[model samples]
Target: MLSWPDELTTELRHDLFGWCELWSVPTLADEVTVAVSRRLTSSLGRANYRHQRVTLQHTLLHPMAAALLREVLCHELAHLAAYRLHGTKIRPHGREWKALLIAAQYPPNVTYAAESLPACFAVHKRFRRPPARRSSWARLTQWIAGIPCAVR
Candidate 1:
């Protein structure tokens, strides 16, 4: 039942929008859903391509550093970005993903040392990462902008 502060969600959304703009992709800002979950057992964050959602591990929020959270957020979002640009058949950490990470100003490291955090957060959970089709924050935002201002 852990949840993120509204301000944190705002910041994350802003970052996602910025990345979308950087890539010149179509967007509907509100479409890139962010969910908090305590169910994650091995990863701090995950991106679901089918639903255009990013799930953050709830337990990690309290004890994990903001920088770490930001990094993980960007990492998970990059997966979505890469998927949007490439088909689902592409490799998870393939060239397209690396390119997107570089463009997004992320370190492009496939694996992170989740052990740095305290035991309060289960940083070792194995979350699923899906390959993507063409849908992203940019496209979501653009689509939303065309309609009325919606937040969902």
Candidate 2:
């Protein structure tokens, strides 16, 4: 029972270890590491079996998204679980992985619904266009016409 980092709540740790135990791979917990990635904008989570690490999107850390966070965590953990149990020959989202997710009580869906994401983690809102800066050509034309440059 290694103490996980602050990002992993006690409940999450319990679920993670419990899954590993259920799969008869109790030592898997020690082999895996979980991390939060602010750079992960396009995806909710990623699992790297080669490195035995799971990287979750930073937004999932928000308390408002706790349920989603757990699901994504379980999703990634299932990847690791399948790899450990089945080796490299299995498809990434094949029956084995789906079964693991089902066994863990999560839907075996390959991807989450975008609308289900918390608004704070919306991609469009996070990277909003910076006030539509006037191009240099627009500014030059406005200067020649003695007109004030307005951002469009």
Residue 152, candidate 2: Cα error in Å is 36
Off by over 4 Å in 1: 1-9, 26-28, 111-152
lDDT of 2 by residue, 57-117 (tens): 7656766568877887887888788888998678776789789988988767653223322
Q: Alpha carbon lDDT of residue 66, candidate 2? A: 81
The TM-score leader among the candidates is: 2
Candidate 2 off by > 4 Å: 1-3, 111-152
Worst 10 residues of 1 by lDDT: 117-126
Error of 2 at 71 (Å): 0.6
59 in model 2: Cα distance from truth in Å? 0.2
Clashes of each: 17, 0
Output the TM-score of candidate 1: 0.64
Which candidate number maximizes lDDT?
2
Cα lDDT tens digits for candidate 1, 25-80: 54624457667665663445677778777777653355324665666566666667
- Clash pairs, candidate 2, are none
